[model samples]
Structure formats: C-alpha cells, structure tokens
Target: MTASSTTTPALAKEVALLAVLATLWGASYTFIRIGVETIPPITFIAARTLIAGGLLVAIIKMRGLSLPKDPAIWKRFFIQACINSVIPFTLIAWAEQTVNAGLATILNSTTPIFAFLLTVLITRHEAVTMRKLLGTIAGVIGISLIIGMEAFQGVGKELVAQLAIVAATISYAAAAIFGRGFKGLDPMMPAAGSMICGAVILIPVSLVVDQPWTIAPSADSLLALLGLSVFSTALAFVIYFRLIHTLGSVSTTSQAYLRVPIGVGIGVIFLGETLASTALTGLVFVVIGVAAMTFPSRKKTVPV
Candidate 1:
C-alpha cells in the first residue's frame, strides 16, 4: 500500500470529528437558551466551567498525566480562561436570554473573520490575499446588516445582547491567536487548564452575586446545563483539540461555520423559534463570508 492509501482514511476521520465538533457546539446555543431561563448568566457559566474542568482533569489523571507545575504556565492558562471561557461564556449566556439561539449562533460564528483581520492588522501571522480582504468586507457587511435589520424592530435590549455576542466573537478571535502560543504543549493542557482557571475565576463571582443556591432552576434548565458542560464544552474541547492537532487550526476552525445552520435548526425544531427574513439574509452573508475567509485558497498562501 502506498502513502496515499494510508492517509485517506485518517483524513476522513478528522473530517468526521470536525462535523461532530460543530454539532456539539451548535447544540450549546440551545442549551444556553434553556439554561439562562432560570440560571443567571454568571452562575450558569461558572457551573459550566467547573463541571467541564473537573471532567478534563479526570481525563488527564486517567491518562497518567498531570497539569503543568510551573506558575507561569498556569498564569497563561488564567489569561486563556478569560478570553476563551470566563468572559465569552458569560456574555453568550447572558445574551441568549434576550437573543434567540439561532441569531447568537450566526453572530458568534464569525471567529475566523475576526481572527483573520487580527492577523492582518496586529499579528501579521497569515498571508494577506485578495480573497481574505473581500472576506473581511463581506463579514463586516453581514454583521452590519444583521444589526441594522434588527433595529427596525426597536429591539433595544436585544441590540445590546447582539453586540455582546460580537464582543464574545472578538474574544474568541484573540483566544485563537493567543492559543498559538501553546503549539508545543499537549493540546489538552490548555483545554483543561483554562477551564479549571475559568472555574476558579467565575465560581466565586457566581456565589457572591447570583447566590445560585437561591435560584430554583427547572428540570430543562438543569438538563441543559449538564449537556452544555459535558457534551458541548468538555467533549467538544477534546474533539477540537484533536482536530487542531490533526487537521491544523485553519481546517478545524473553518468547519465551525457549520454550527450556524445546526444551531439554527436546533432552535427552530426544539425551541420553536423562527428567524426574520432579513436575519436569514444576514446569515447567508455570514456563511458566505466565513467560507471565503476560511476555505483553503486555490492560490498559494502562507501559514503562520
């Protein structure tokens, strides 16, 4: 057997894992929607990090590995937690209370676009190309359209929520850029460490402000929280790390736009939600723009 025969099945497996990652993350939008109904955003996200972090820790231990002993590494983990989880996760949970799950999915799915722009401006990590420049313009236009279309409805609080999701998208972009600093470490280290650090940061805030004990979350909310913590956050992180290792960051994150449609479908079917015609149009632009940003160019491009 030649090298081509050996590599094909492995490549196919990575692609399959990417699809699974999209579904898990896509479902998280509905989970947050259901959870934030009764659970406050900070408390909900705190629990999510804590539960998922514990699971990752256990997995590491079972593998006969331990988290880094260096304080510097843990400090970096803390920063990662802020951008990757603590801030963005809380923002998404809070926003989902007002924003529909489907819209949240579309808004948050622009990570690669922002990552690309950041690369162009600050990092200069990736090669600039005509396609990427056009992609950036399309993404900005798509976002503007979504917000502008919503404004006609006089969605005051919803506007703030939408912007919050956008900010979360920015945080995700920075996280991706900073995540490159972890190229030499085991992928699970950042995934697990940042989660644990996020828990440490948020749990105290949840107790003091939300007083989560006083809140009586419903069965659906509890179930959603569990699902979000386990399947979406922990398992999805594991799969994402695996894909990043096997498929490369560009390939792994590129498939994330698939979560947009999956999230919208879950909201429509499970939550009985519907999007306005204008919003649907915006979603189309986002998908197309992200495709332009992330899809492998036929032309030669530099990877940083």
Candidate 2:
C-alpha cells in the first residue's frame, strides 16, 4: 500500500472525530440553558465542573493513567483548568441568561478563527495563507451579521452578553493553544487534573458568590443540571480526548464551526427559534467560512 492511501484514511478519521466533538459541544448550550433556568449560573457551572472532574478522575484511575507530579507541570495544569474550564464555563452560563442558546453557540463558534490567528501571531507556529485569511474575514463578517440581526432589539445588555460569549471563545482558543504543553502526559490524567483544579477554584467562588443552597430548582431543572454535569461536561471531555488523539489540536478544535448549525437546528426544532432572512444569510456565510478555513490544504510536493 502507498503512504498516500494511509494518509487519506487518517484524514477521514480526523474529520469524523471532529464532527462528533462538534455535536457534543453544540448540545451543551441547550443543556446549559435548561440547567440555568432554575440553578444560578455560578452554582450550575461550579457543580457541573466538580461532578465532571470527579468522573474524569475515576476514569483516569480505572485506566491507570498518571498525572504529572512535577510542581511546574501541576501549576500549568491548574492554569489550563482555570482558562479552559472555570472561566469560560462560568462566563458562558452568565452570558446565556440574556442570550438564547442558539445565538450563544453561534458566537462561541468563533474559537477556530481566534485559534488560527493566535497560532500564527503568538506562537509563531502556523503560517497564515490567503484562503485561511479570507475565511477568517468571512467568519468575522458572519458573526457580525448574526449579532447585529439578533441583538438589535435588546441592544445594550444583550450586546454585552454576546461579547462575553465571544470572550469565552477567546479563552477556549487560548486553552487549545495552551493545551499543547500537555502532549507528553496521558490525555486523561491532565484532563482530569485540570478539571479537579477548576472545580476547586469554582466551588468556593460559587458558594460565596451565588449561595445556591438558598434557592431550589424545579425537578425538570434539576434533571437538566444532572445532564449538563454528566453528559455535557463529563462525557464531552472523554470524547474530546479521543478526538484530540486522533486528530491534531487544530483539526479537533475545528468542531467549533459545526456547533453553531447544530445549535440553530435544535433551536428551530425544539426552542421554536425563528431566524430572519438576514440571519439565515449570515448562517450561510458561517457555513462557507468554516468550510474554507477547516479544509486541510495538501502539498503534493514533498521535501527531500
């Protein structure tokens, strides 16, 4: 068999893996909305991370994976946890209060564009090309259109919330870049450790900030919280690791694009969301931009 044949199969697997990641992340917005309806945003995020962290730790133990014992590595893990889990998790929850899940998901989909720029600018790792540059431009335009159309009616506060969600995407981009540091560690162990640290930081903050014990939620909301903690946060991490192992970080994180469409589909089907023609046009641009940015460019000329 030729080397080219093997590479094609691997690329196919990477694409498929990213698609699964997209589905898991896209559904998270809906679950978050349901959970936050009765649970305070801080409480929901803290508890969600805590429970997911515990589950991940258990899975790591079962798999016999080891976390880094070095203090420096542990510190990095803590930072990654804070950036990837705690900050974005809480921010998105708070932002979702005023924003619908679909719109929030659309805003969050900007992670890849940010990741591309960060990789090129800060890390000096990847080169930016004309196609990717154009795609990133189109992606920004798409996001602007979506935000402009959806957020006009409730301008001031809603705009802030939308920007907060975009900030969460920036955090996610940083996390994706920062996560490269953990290449040598077993993915599960670092993943678990980070969540453990995140939960530690968030739990105290949630208790102090939200005082969630004072408020109780309806049974439906409670169930939603359970689903958010278990499925969205915990299981999602497990699947994410598998994808990361199969695809490189950039490929795996490309799931950010697909999340928006899935969120929109769920909104139309379940939440009864009605998109204006303008919003739909913007959605088309998003799809085009994602396809442009994520398609892996091939080099037929090999270096000797």
Candidate 3:
C-alpha cells in the first residue's frame, strides 16, 4: 500500500475525533449556561478544571505513564493553561451567564479566522493557501447561518459579555497555535497538565470571590458542572491535543466550525427552539469549509 493510502485512514480517524471534540464542546455551551445560572463562574470553572485535571492525572497513572518531571515542560504547561483554559474558559462561562449561548457559539466560532491570520502572519510555519483562506470565510458564514441572524438581537445590549466571548475566541485560536509546542508529549500529558495548572490558578480566586461553602448550588447547576468537567473538558481536551498533533492548529480549530451547528442543534432539541431553513444551508457550508481546511491538499507533481 502507498503512503497516501495509508495516511488517508489515519487522517479519517483523526477527523472523526475532531467531530467528537466539536460535539463535546458544542454541548459545553449549554452546560456552562446551566452551570453559571446558580454557580459563580470562577467557582464553576475552577471546579471544572480541578475535577477534569484530577481525573486525567489518575488515568495517566493507571496507564503507567508518568508526567514529565522537567520544569521546562511544566512551565510550558502553565503557559498553555493560561491561554487555553484559564482565560477562555472563565470568559466564556462568565459571558454565558448573560449573553445567550447561541450568540456565544456564533461568536466563538471565529477561531479559524484568527488562527488563519496568526498562522499566516505570525507563525508562518504552516502553508498559507487561498483554499484555507476561503475555508476560514466559509466557516464564519456557516456559523452565522446556523445560529440565525436573530441571535444577534441582544448583541449591543450585552456589549461586555459579547466582547468577552470574542476575547475567548482569540484566546482559543492562540491556544491551538501554541499547542503545537506540545508535539512530542503524549496528548494526555498536556491536557492533564494544563488543566492542573488552570485549577491551581483559578481555585484561589474562586475561594476568595465565590466562597464555595456559602453557596447552595442547584441540582441542574451541579449536574451541568459534572458534565462540563467530564465530557466537555477532560475527554474533549484529549481529543483536542491529538488533533493539534495530527491535523495542525488551523485545521484542528476548524472544529469551531462544527461546534456552532451542533450547539444550536442541542439547544433546539432540549430548549424547544425551532431550527430555521437557513441552518441546513449553513451546515452545508460548514462541511465544505471544514473539508477545505482539513483534508491534505494534493501537490501537483512534475513528471520527470
């Protein structure tokens, strides 16, 4: 079998993981929304990191693979935590308390746009192609369609919350780009390490601000936190890091394209919201965009 043929199956597996990642995170919006309804964002996300981080660390131990003892690796883990989990996770959690999850999903789907720009201008390591650029545009268009233009009705009303989500989107893009540095390690190491680092930072703030002992969290909120911590965070981060290793940052972030539709679909089914006709069209654009960014471009060969 040729290299191309062998590579195809592996890429397909990775892409399938990408879709799973998207689904996990897409559902996280609702989790965050429910979680922040009764729980403070700081405490909620802090617990999320702590729970997810602890779980992954236990899993790593069970596998008989210890995390690297290098301080440099830990330092990188700390940095990744700040960019990937701490900033973005907290911001999104805080934002969803006020801004609706649909708009947040729409806003958050811009990761590829920022990733595309960062890859081309700052990193310049990845190939910058017109196809990828078009893919970036198409992804945004898809998100807007999937969420429906009506989702923007509260945009100006919640300016700060909206901007918070935008900032989170930028942070996510940077995280995907920065994640390339963790290439050599097992995907779980960075996933677990970063979550631990995030928990270390956020827990103190939560203690001071939220005072977890004082609050009585509702059953819905508690369940939401568990869901977010387990499925959307711990498991999702494993898949996320794997994709970053296999698919590159920009393509991995293309999962944000998928998240919008999946998020909306979740909301529709659970919340009794109606799906619009345009949403179907948007999904088509999304598939096209993700395909453009994800699949390896065939290099035209020179016949010798």
Candidate 4:
C-alpha cells in the first residue's frame, strides 16, 4: 500500500472524531446553562469535576494502568488540573450567569489564538507565522463584532460579565499552551490525574464559598449536574486526549470553531434565543479565522 493511501483513512477518522468532539462540546454550553439555573456555579463546577475525576480514576484502576507515583510529577499533575479543569471551568460557569451560552462559546473559540500568541511570546517554542498572526487578528475582530459595539455602549454589570467570559477564553488558551508541559506522561493518566486534583482543590473552595449544604437543588438540576460530570467533564477529556494523540494539538484545537454553530443551533432550539444578522456575520468570520489558524500548513517532503 502506498503511504498516502494508508494515511488517508487515518486522517478521515481523526476528522470524524473532531466532529463528534465539537458536537459534545457545543452541547456542553446548553447543559451548563441548565445546570447553573438551579445550582450555584462554584458548587456545581466542583461537584461535577469531583464526580468525573472519581469515575475516571475508577476506570483507570479497573484497567490496571500504572499512574505516576513521583511527588514531583504529581505536583505538575496538580498544576495541570488547576489549569485545565479548575480555573477555566469556574470562570465559564460564572460568566454564563449573564452572558448567552452561544456567544460565550464563540468567544471561547479564540483559545487557539491565545495558544499561538503564548507559544510565541512565552515559551519561544514556535515562531509566529504571518498566516497565524493574521488569523489571530481576524479572530479578535470577529469576536468583537459578535459581541457588538452597542452592547458595550450602555452597560454596567452586564458588560463586566461579558468581559469575564472573554477572560475565561484567555484562561482556556493559557491552559492549552501550558498543558504542553505534559509531553512525557501517558495521556490518559494526565487526564485522570488532573481531574482528581481539581476535585480536591475545588472541594474546599466550593464548601467555603457555595455552601452546598444550605443550597437546595431540584431533581432536574441534579440530572443536569450528572450529565455535566459524566459526559462533558469525564467523557469529553477522554475523547480530547484521543484526538490529540491521533491528530496532534493543532488539529484537535480546530474543533473549537465547530462549537459556535453548534451552540447557536442549541440556543435557538432550546433557549428560544433570537439571532441577529450581525451575529451571523461574526460567526462566519470566527469560523473562517479559526479554520485558517488551525489548518495544517506543513507539507511532507519526499526523500529520494
């Protein structure tokens, strides 16, 4: 079999996985909206991560996969948990209190732009190409357009809430680049470990801040929390790691673009939200700019 022919099916499978990832992640905003309606944000986030972490750890033990035992590695694992699970998760949940879920997801798509800029400025690992720089600029413009200048004009708390959502996007981007530190560990181990650490960290914070013992939740809210823990937090990370393994970071991150359309559809169908013409144009730009940023630019050279 020729190399190109052999590789085509692998590429096709990765694309399919990304599509599924996009759908799952897109629906997550809807689930978060449902969840936050009844449950306090900090408590809800902490509980979901805890449950998801416990589930993954159980699975790992059942499968007999060896997890790292070094205290140093464990520290990094804890940091990874904070970056990947704790901070951004909390930020997005709180931001969703005021911001629409769809718009929030669209802003979250700027994560790769942050990842790229961070890679260039912080690590000095990857050089900034003109295409990537242009893509980042366009993405910022697109996000600004989506939120609209008018929304910014006459606002008080709502404007700050929107800014918080944008800040969450920055956290996500930092997390993406920061997670590159986990290159040597088994992928599933890091996924499971960080979740476990996040649970540990969030438990104390959630107890003190949210005081779940006092806050009552409806049955529907409980179910939403279960879905968030099981599907969005646990299963989502597994699929994310699998995609990264198969397609690398660049391709896996491109799935962010798909979240916008998916979130928009969910918003209209479930939340009864109206879409503006301006939002549509901004969505198109975000989709295009993210695609431009993530599409593979490197071509394999043939050796004689």
Candidate numbers, best lDDT first, in rank order: 1, 3, 4, 2
What is the C-alpha RMSD, rounded to one decimal, of candidate 2?
2.8
Clashes per candidate, residues 3 or more apart or on different chains:
0, 0, 0, 0
* Candidate 3 accuracy as TM-score: 0.81
| Per-residue lDDT over 169-210 for candidate 4, one digit per residue giving the tens place of the 0 to 100 score | 777778777677788877788888888899899889989988
lDDT of 2 by residue, 1-304 (tens): 9888999988887677667667777888888877788889888888887888899988877887656689998899899988898889889999888787887777777777887888888997887799889888887888788778547676688788888898898999899889888887888877788888988888898889888888788887778778777877778788888876777555665676778788877766766767767667777777667667777787598666
C-alpha lDDT of candidate 4 relative to the true structure = 0.81
Clashing pairs for model 1 are none
| Best prediction by TM-score | 1
Model 4 bad stretches (over 4 Å): 1-10, 301-304
What is the TM-score of each predicted model, taking all chains together? Answer: 0.95, 0.89, 0.81, 0.92
Worst 10 residues of 1 by lDDT: 295-304
Error of 1 at 234 (Å): 0.6
Off by over 4 Å in 3: 1-17, 137-157, 241-254, 273-292, 299-304
In model 2, which regions exceed 4 Å deviation?
A: 1-17, 149-155, 301-304
Q: Across residues 121-204, which tens digit of lDDT does each residue of candidate 3 receive? A: 898987778998898788778766755454666545466676788789889889879988887898899889999999999999
